[model samples]
Target: MRNPKKYCEIWKLQKSFPSPKGPAIVVKDFDLFLRDGEFVSLIGHSGCGKSTVLSILAGLTTKTAGSIILADKEVRGAGPDRGVVFQAPCLLPWMSAFDNVMIGVDQVFPSAPRAQRRQIAEHYLELVGLADSVHKMPAELSQGMRQRVGIARAFALSPKMLLLDEPFGMLDSLTRLELQQVLLEVWRERKITALMVTHDVDEALFLSDRIAMMTSGPGANVGDILEVPFARPRDRKAVLEHPDYYRLREHLIGFLEGQDHRKPKPVAAEEPLAISAAVLSPA
Candidate 1:
């Protein structure tokens, strides 16, 4: 596929939290960009602040400094246009699968008729293979099934940019592969810009158009970028068989290994979203 125009531009990104010792800087001076409707992944070892970047983009977590521009306007806080699926499904337990998804669809399409909103929710739930389980409550569903609902909910809003933070991190190997395929099928149809954070290299390789490598933290930032040369509309089998697959894989492994020596166990500090009310608003 030909290159798409610049869509989401993140420049000089920085974040820090107050520490007993001092301010703990997690990310600093991070710069990156995504083409319109492109699928990109931020890959790094744990504690590298990859999730921090995604949260900032989602407006769930506020940045200490810098700017994120999406769809031509500055991103001040979370809105319906950017959909986020975190490591955990984060669904409301009381709500049934259909209602879980409807929460977002209703918010995003409030002007539409009630029947239209129901149609939108059912469409994405079916798209994610949850058509049979639409009425099940969160406690009644398996972990993978819950994540599927989260994916469906995110897409139900018809977001312009989708932010995923280790979306498959909690699943079993078999289930992980299953969800990966499901995610791609839905994404292919939507053609929305997506940015995912993950530590799994092969998972990144299979799903991303380009992978951004981050340096180790206390002040993590972009180390390098690898363009995934595999043609789009891809499948796992074809990607594994493609020439140069290992070459790209090796480069990512090599970069991470080099950063391992400096990698401290990630800091366990959560800062209050105590900035502007815009910072505390949900994405």
Candidate 2:
């Protein structure tokens, strides 16, 4: 068997915040390694610092400890090499869908001719099934359409890594499924390394090469990492029929259930307060 090439590495990542009551550690000793063109999903209970991990990986948040190495370079801050799609579409109100994607392409490929940049933008938009809505504003588009613009904009950069923080958490079931398929198609085509923080177990099973299950925080860490054995061009119906699917599903569901029953440590009066999920910024 061929050895997988390492693309990104996270070692002993930790994050903490100062609270009035004490220093609350939200993430502790979290570690993960991604191979080139691999898709990994981080799954955990709400407030288990899932988004915090992504934020740190995106260079949006500073880690209190450990290291994040991408392509052999230490990640200190955000760069064009990493593209992030948040829960909200975050499209600029005035920019049309085409213009929105163009901004990212221009930033990442500044030396390219203007025509080429525009073409890149248009190509990604079409890939996401938004060819006709290229000129539509965010307000004019449906929620799902707006998110599609965001996805296109991110992919237009052709980043080495993509960070997704619950990008489909807000959509309706049908729209979520549709966007998931679109995202999978794009990922298959580009094969970019992706790390997504998702609460959906089925979504993780459908999309990731491996699922990193985290324990509940006041210092959450990876509790289990499960390899997804399903073949590519994965069909939802076919996935449901696979015998291991239910076994994996039940394992993930049971893990979260156990996490839900674990209580967080209490904060002391003299120390800084514990970091609540509300305080952490969305990636």
Please name the candidate that would achieve the greatest TM-score relative to the true structure. Answer: 2
Q: In model 1, which residue pairs have backbone atoms overlapping below 3 Å?
A: none
Cα lDDT of candidate 1 equals 0.88
Give the per-residue lDDT of model 2 (tens digit) for 148-216: 998998899999899999999999999999999999988878998999999999999999999999888
Model 1, 1-283: lDDT tens digits are 3334668989889899887856787887788999998999999889778999999999989999999988788999889899999899999999999999999999998999999999999999999999999999999999999999999999998998999999999999999999999999999898889999999999899999999998777667888889999987988999999998999999999988877865364454432222212221221
- Write down the TM-score of every candidate: 0.91, 0.93
Each prediction's whole-model lDDT (CA): 0.88, 0.88
Candidate 1: deviation at residue 262, Å?
3.0
TM-score, candidate 2, is 0.93
How much does candidate 1 score in TM-score?
Answer: 0.91
